[model samples]
Target: MPDLHSIPYLVGAGIVLLHVIGILHVIHAIMTVRTSQGTIAWMVSLIAAPWIAVPIYWVAGRSRFSGYVRARRSDDAELLKLSDDMHRRLREYEIKPDDAFGRAAQFLGGLPFTRGNELTLLIDGEETFESIFKAIHAAEKYLLVNFFIVKNDRIGTRFKDALIARAKAGVQVYFLFDEIGSHRLSRSYLNEMKEAGIHCSHFGANRHWWSRLQINFRNHRKIVVADGKEGFIGGLNVGDEYLGRDQRFGAWRDTHLKLKGPSVQAIQLVFIEDWNWATDEVPDLEWTGQEHTADQVAAIIPTGPADPADSWQLVVAEAANSAQERLWIASPYFVPDGGVLTALQAAAIRGADVRILIPEKADHLLVWLSAFTYYEQTIPFGVKLYRFKKGFLHQKVILVDNKLACVSTANLDNRSFRLNFEISGLTPDPVFVGEVAEMLENDFGNSEPVKVSDFTARAFWFRLACRVARLMAPVQ
Candidate 1:
């Protein structure tokens, strides 16, 4: 098998490439790094087979993005410190489900599901803006605004301008955005905020190829809180498309919320943690005590790789299991995890009305393909699925018993469950929950359901390719 004939020429080419790399290294020291003998041993593994070795490093190497990684893992320490306390609060109550997804109620959303929380579902984008701005206008101590996509466009400009204004007004504002997801925003926009005294940080930015594991970890949550008084959460973001202004997406359908209660404090905590991670700026722990409104709040749930509460995943499972009359699901990306898919199928098999509505054409094709491959298993379990024929459906919501549900930033993929930091609000309030469920039903009615046999009988190779792609899918 040895082809000695061309070995000399191939060797010559490798030598040329190495020379170019050496020259570049001399120019900028981009790849050159300080090292010790032990460090040199670790470095050798990277050069031996970079492509394969790089990925392994990513899965196991140290993260240079996490500011505290060099110090100590604070998330772990805080989690352990409060583990016993969190356990007691968790054991306080059991979830109640008559016919919907929470029938078995494994999550135990505490004893008082809707007891002290004052949850409000905001139906108007304009109203959400006004509410958030009003809270920002009323900021006394600190303001935390985090978003995945913060463009320099119309809505984004306004939000940024307000934050800048608040910072100038002596309000402490921390802004956290994803590096890759929000890459479209120009340096000028960020500079303007910095000039105005706003403390900003980008989640997981530049790193060497060998040290860039979990680089895909994103910050997908959309939240805005002012002095922990008023909190805004849900699917809406700072984009005209979110406000139904996109010419292509006529009459955009989306959902957002303004939560006022003790839960808002929890939302603020996540922002502070992100701020600490990105900028190494320790936020005031007592900042949580300052509330704009002393309203009763619900879960105040946030989840990600750094936190292993699994509150988001468990919430989804409970919602699916508690499905009563119907379970309506709508998400831009519908690639569910094992526990989520199981609970959904089980609910349908148990005779709960289950309908899943996803977009026919989304911005991400791999996600769509993976979701489509599960039609056979899901449909056979009595799960009715619909595909939106219009534009992308970026909203993530679940309706169970038309009484309890959630609107979340978390996707069904593993990235959302275990990697990316995300936020979601789960509520048992019938009015808002009913609205969320009914809205999903309207979306389902606007689209066509997937024929079970037809989907199962697709071309073998197409299905096979999709199955293969599924292996590469994001995981928790």
Candidate 2:
């Protein structure tokens, strides 16, 4: 037998230990991974290269966010009571859903479709920020501000100054941001807001030792509420690039929704949960609903990894399945999971006017490449794809038949479906649907139809790269 002190013996023992650990991880992945493709992929990689795959699997493989769930369920009696009170107050304004998609959404989100809401579609950065800053400035009692990214650049400074001004005016301002998304945000930026008496904290997923290696999950919801009466949610973050100031991606196209009425309270509830997760304390804010003159019906759907199932994926699939006339979706990232893809194809096959609008310019190379691989699978079933030519399409808007429209922080990818904490504003009001339809019509007018040959006609290396990128979709 080899000596235990020898380097070669130690090396052999290390290899055995790694393989044993890899097998354990493989077991964990098999028991926990949500998708079959992801399970098979991890099984192969873990067995073949335990040293590399083990570390990666440790970081990105886990599907459940136990820490978040624990935070939500912990002895937080006050938070639970606040949530119960908010829902109790919203019960009077709740509208029972009559359609399949609506029912699915209501069941998945645990929030009812609320009436007496007025929704305004804010297109692009200028309009969104203008409305948000105005709300911040006008906030008299309190403000709830949260975003996935908050930069230290010009727009961010403007946002900071707006909050500071309000805090100085005696408004109780609470700010929350994703640590991963806003890693570049300086401590000085947060200090300034703190000095002005604004409460600030990052959605600290790494606060616990067990969760330190789990960085795949992110809080991607963008929300701002003023006095618990009006609110904003969508894809726009606080950055100059979002305003189309970056030379690399000019004319940044996006969308946000402004809400006035009971639904604003729903948005506020989401913020409360996130804030509670970030800083184990509940803020004092209004839980009552305010009726708007327009009297529109809307629901706020929040989804995340801590959920019982893939909520966003189910919502999108249900939307596709329930659409009878048209289903138009706009997102920068177009990579979809198998279930969602099948739903889209089935929607097309059932004679729905299925159209997917994606950006012509890519901000994420892997996700963009992965999108191409799906054309052959979808185009054959009459699902049409469009590439926005005027600018980069960063909006996450879904229009279902002329009846339902949604502006959400979630994207049409596995990341948004499974990894990120996201919120959506969904409405079935005719006037609001008409507005969304008009907005999408203008967008389609500026887009070019994509042909299946867009992928088939590409070179062998390019096609191979797309397939390789697609294999990484679960974590992307």
Candidate 3:
């Protein structure tokens, strides 16, 4: 018999047990239906004692498509035109010499690759903010904004003010921010936006601890489209750190793209899908689209929790598998799950020039340790590694065959690949790819190579620490 004081705790445990049992039933049903290579013993245990299996699955299992749910039919018709425009860019590689990369860049991003999108890269965060704001101020009709981290800081306030002004001026603005990623924002900010007439909503931020099943699912997409003619994407977030004002990290090194073309429509569609998910509202379709160009301009690789197709991860896998000449990856967090790690090892084994870039200092101690331990195996495959001592090198850019690149908010880690909703754009334009390649080579120039000896020098406990963290990758 439990004491009266222990009732709540016991009840909580019992509820968790109940759910675990339910999940086991779900898993058993799924395994039986699919005839998976999944362990029969595990399935039996899951059915017999779900509590144990639920924890293991969360930490180590790959979630099947049947296990997750996607957006409903109400996910706005307004996205159709924008999606069509974006799809066209993805299929057609039409543009000037300024846009084309190497010969492979012409065909690498997939079928119908085109190179005609006019693009401008903004280096300064403050300048990027001002440029985007100016475009917003000048907008005549629509504005779509998406961000992974949208805080209520100085920039957020300014952005909010701008959106309110635009709303007053009658521009239809749809703002989408991830619930968990931007969890720091107060209710007041949202209330203020609604009051000011701006349409704002949050992506999956299920805080209910009882069943926050997909809290790992985050919208790591940072995009903006104005009047369906202009678009922007890249790593710039609305914060002082982005402006290089932080005393800790010296200069903020990041990239954001300014697009003047039909590609903007596709990015806009990405926003609409998320907006509809949050608000359950259908938007008007067939509005006048602003044409920015005819030359093949840009392409988008949309990623998220709602995608039933799991396209982004496949693209990454394909890029890794397709690397014949060389592969250069610059990511702040270099923890790739077993699948990606296997791909890197295989690519290196096949004699592809494989190199990875990570940050020098630890952002998250556990994640860093797990990655460092994994390095012991990677170096053996001739997979070179580097640490950008310049700052927190939080970049997720990949250059394959010295031509094509997948740049986005998605990190190479398992969290970004399978759990988070991330977006990246594909560029086949030789000019853009050339500039990007040069930038990567330059990064390798200044960064220090993380040698194998570095791992051996770590204290025994530190190495042990990473081994433990690795066990948690499945849940992450």
- Please write out the lDDT profile of model 1 over residues 337-373, one tens digit for every residue: 6788999999998889888887776566677778877
**Which candidate do you rate higher for lDDT, 1 or 3?**
3
TM-scores of all predicted structures: 0.75, 0.98, 0.81
Best by lDDT: 2
Provide the overall lDDT of each model, using Cα atoms, as 2-decimal numbers. Answer: 0.66, 0.93, 0.68
Badly placed stretches (over 4 Å) of model 1 are: 1-53, 56-115, 205-213, 247-250, 285-297, 309-311, 453-468
* Candidates 2 and 3, the one with greater TM-score: 2
TM-score of 3: 0.81
Candidate 2 C-alpha lDDT tens digits along 202-294: 898436866867889899999999999999999999999999999988999999999999999889889998998888778988888999889
Instruction: Specify the highest-TM-score model's number.
Output: 2
Worst 10 residues of 3 by lDDT: 97-106
